[model samples]
Target: MRAVACVLFILSLVWDSVRADNSISSLKMAAASWEGELPCKEWNCECAFKQRGCCCAATDLQEVEDQIFHKVMDLSRRVFQLGDTILEVLGGIRVAFTASMSHKKTCFGPFTRSTPIPYNLLTFNHGSGYNPALGIFTAPRPGLYSFSFSVYSKVQGEGEKMYYKVQLMRNGEAVVSTWEDNREDSEDSSSQTVLLSLEQGGQVYVQLLSGRQLCGNIEGLNTFSGALIYPTLT
Candidate 1:
C-alpha cells in the first residue's frame, strides 16, 4: 500500500508541473500574438514565452515613441517652411517716397529763397497735393511695414512761421501724425516713425501749414522730407 501511494503521489506532482508549464506556454503565446511574431512551438515553449513577452513590451514602447517623434518633426518642418516663405515675400514689397521743395514764394518780404530745397530731410510725394480731410496712405502690398518722416522749417516771427505736419496713413486712416511749430524765430525740426500692417494699394501723404509773416528772416524758408516703407519681422 505504501509503494502504491508513493507512485500515485509522484504522478500527481508530475501532472501539476505539466499543468503549470501549459499555463506559462499559453501566456507566452498570447504575448507573441501581441508582438506580431511567430507562435511558440511545443518543444521550445520556454524560450518562446520569454522572448515573446520581452519583444511585445519593447515593441509597444518603441511604437509609441516613434509616433511622438514623427509628430514633432512634422510640426518643426512646417514652421521652418512658413518662416522661409514670409522672408521671401517681405523681400519683394518695400517702397519709399522722397519729397523736396521745388518752389518757394514770399508774399510781402525781400524773400531770397531758392527753388529745389536741399535734400536735408525725408518726405513723400503723393499723386495729388496733401489734403487734411484724407488721412491714410494705401499700401502697395500686404505686409508688415515701417513708416518714417522728417520735418524741416524756418522760424519767422511770432505769427509768421512755417508749420509742417507728418502723418502715417493706411487705407485713408491716420495711424500716426506729428507737427512742428516754427513760429518763434528759432530753427525747428521734427520727425516721426511708426509701424503698420498694411494691405496692398494703400496710400500715404504729408501736409504743410504756413503761419503768418513775422519780423525775422523769412526769405529762403523751404523744407524737404520723405517717407520710407519697409518690411519688418515683427
Candidate 2:
C-alpha cells in the first residue's frame, strides 16, 4: 500500500507537462476492479511502476480534473467573445436607407423643352442619403438598390392636356421613365420603380424632362425613395 501511494505521486508530476490541450490521459495502472484510475498509458505501466509511480488518488486527481474544466470553460468564453465582436462589426456595414420628398405644392414649369425637376421638399430622409437641396442620393456603399418615384400634375381646365414626365437618372444617364398625358382627365399622374446595382459614390435622382411641367399638391404624393437590397461593402 505504501509503494502504491509513492508510485501514484510520481505520475501526478508528469500530468502537468503531458496534458496541455485538455484531453484526459488513459490510465496505465488500471485495476481489474472499480477502485481507482491511473493517468499513464497502458503500455508503459511496468516502466512507470519501476521508475516513477502508479497514479494519483481520487481526491488529488479530482483537483486536476476541476482545473482542466475551468481552463476549458475559460477558452470557450474567449471564443464566444471573439465571435460576438465579429458579428457587431459585420452588422455596422449592412447598407440600408429609405427617403422621400414632401407632397406639398412644388412646380417646375413652362420650359420649351425637357428639364430636370428638382424635388426640393424632403419629407423623410432615412440614413440622410437623400439630399433635398441637390435632389440626389449618393450611394454610400456598393449594392443592389431599389428606387421609386411618383409624379403628379394638373392643368387649369378640364379639356387641357397635362404633360407630366420624369425619368430616373443615374449619374446623368436616364434609366427608367414615367409619363402622363390626359385624354378625358385634366390631371395626370404616373409612377415608376427601378432596381439598379450601384457602386459606392454613384448618384441617383429623379429628373423632370425639359419642356414638361409638373406639380404635386400639399399632400406631398410626389416622392422618391430608395433602399439597399444586397450589400456589396464589407
Candidate 3:
C-alpha cells in the first residue's frame, strides 16, 4: 500500500507540471494529492498500513487511502504506457484544453435557435482538438472526457435580459447547461461541467440560445474547457 502511495507521489509530480495543459494532467495532480501518505519509499517494499505491518486494512482509515492510491495507479497506467515516465507519457499521451471568447469580443448571440458559440481565445489547447474558428471540440481519441463552460452577459439595455442560457453539448446532444438571468445585476454569469464517455472523433461544443447573449472583455469572462479523464483503450 505504501508502495502505491509512493508511486502516486511520483506521478503527482508530472500531474503538477502539466495541469494547465490538459484534463489528464489536471487529474494527475488530483492523483498525486489524494489523501494517502506512502508508508514506504520503495515500491514492493513491505508497508505498515498503520504500525509496522500491523496497520492492517481491517483496522484503518489510511487503508481507504491505500485503496484509492491503487486505483490511481491503475488509472495512471491506463493513461501512460508501461515503463514510460509520467512526463514522457504526457507528451501526446494526454489531451486537454481551456479556451475563451476573445477579449475583444462582446457577445455570442441573439439568434433564433441555439448556435455553436466560438471561443476564439485559447489559453491552452494541449490536444489541438478545439477550433477557434468553428467553436467546436472534436475529440482526438476515445476516452472519458471532462468538459466545462461558463456564460456571462452584460445588461446592455433596459430590455436586454441580464441572463442567458448556454448549453454544453456532446455530439449535438445537450449534456448540461449554464443559465444566468439576474435582472438586479448589470452582469450575470453561470457555468456547467460534465464528464462524458466519448469515442474517437466525437465532438463537444457550446451553444448559445437564440436572442440570448454571452459577453466578455479582454479579461475573458466566458470560457470553455475539457480534458481526457481516462483513456478507455488498454
Candidate 4:
C-alpha cells in the first residue's frame, strides 16, 4: 500500500509540472503575437490566455460564418425571384378569342382613309386579350399565334361595284389582304389565316383600306379569331 501511494504522488507531481510548462508556453506565444496590444481590442472575440491567439481564431471563425450566411441569403432571394417568374409564365396558359361585327344589316365603310374594323361581338375571349372597344387583340405573352379573318360584301345591282379591300394588321402594319373589286358576283366573302410569332403587348386587328366598302348582311360574316399555340418565354 505504501509503494502504491508513493507511485501516485510521483505521478501527480509530474502532471503538475507538465501543466505548468504548457501554461507558460501558451502565455509566451500570446505575448509574442500581441506584444504591445490589448487582448481582443480590435476584434469581437472572447479573450483567452490558455491558447495562443485564441481570440483572433474565434474572430476569424465568426467572419467566415458571416460570409457564408450572406451568401445563403443572396441565393434564397434568387430562388424566390425565379419562382415568381415561373408563376407569371404559367398564368397565361391558353389564350384564344373569336369576335365578329354586331348583328345587323349595315354598311361598314367607303372611308377617305384606312380604318380599323371594330368586331364588337365577342363569341369567346379566353384570356381577355381582345378589346372590342379598341378593335384590337393585344398579346398577353410572347408566343406563336394563329390569326384568321373573313370579309364579306354585297351590292344591290349586278353592274354595281362590289369593291372591298380588307387587311389583317399587326401593330399598324399590314400583313395580309383580301379584295374583290369585280361586279361578277353581287356578293362575296374572302378569308385569310396567318401564323405569327409575337412578343408580349403586340397588337393585331382587321382593317379596311381606303375607298372600299362592305355593304349588306355583314354581321357574323365578318369575323376575326386568334389562338396561342405555345409560349416563347424568351
Candidate 2, residues 1-234: lDDT per residue as tens digits?
A: 444654555446455444654333333323222234443333244554445543334345678799999999999999999999998866655554444445544456757765555557655554567677778888877888998888777676657767767889998899999887765767776788889989888999887777777654614566777887877754
Q: Which scores higher on TM-score, 1 or 4? A: 4
Q: What is the C-alpha RMSD of each candidate to the true structure, in Å?
A: 13.0, 11.3, 25.8, 13.3
Q: Which stretches of candidate 4 lie over 4 Å from their true place?
A: 1-91
Residue 115 CA error for candidate 1 (Å)? 20
Cα lDDT tens digits, model 4, 1-234, are 332333234334345445656564543443444434433344322243344445444656778899999999999999999999998876657799999998565578889999999999999898898999978999988999999999888996668989989999998899999999887889999899999999999999999999998888888999999999898986
Alpha carbon lDDT of each predicted model: 0.45, 0.67, 0.73, 0.80
Q: State each candidate's clash count.
A: 15, 14, 4, 0
Instruction: State the displacement of the C-alpha of residue 155, model 1, in Å, after optimal TM-score superposition.
Output: 3.4
Model 2 error, position 59 (Å)? 6.2
Best by lDDT: 4
Misplaced by over 4 Å in model 1 are 1-91, 106-137, 156-164, 181-183, 209-234
Taking all chains together, each candidate's TM-score versus the true structure is 0.36, 0.59, 0.59, 0.60
Q: Judge candidate 4 against the unseen true structure and give its global Cα lDDT, from 0 to 1.
A: 0.80
| Candidate 3 deviant stretches above 4 angstroms | 1-88, 104-106, 216-219
Q: Least accurate stretch of 10 residues (summed lDDT) in model 1?
A: 108-117
- Residue pairs clashing in model 4 are none
Question: For model 1, what is the C-alpha lDDT against the true structure?
Answer: 0.45
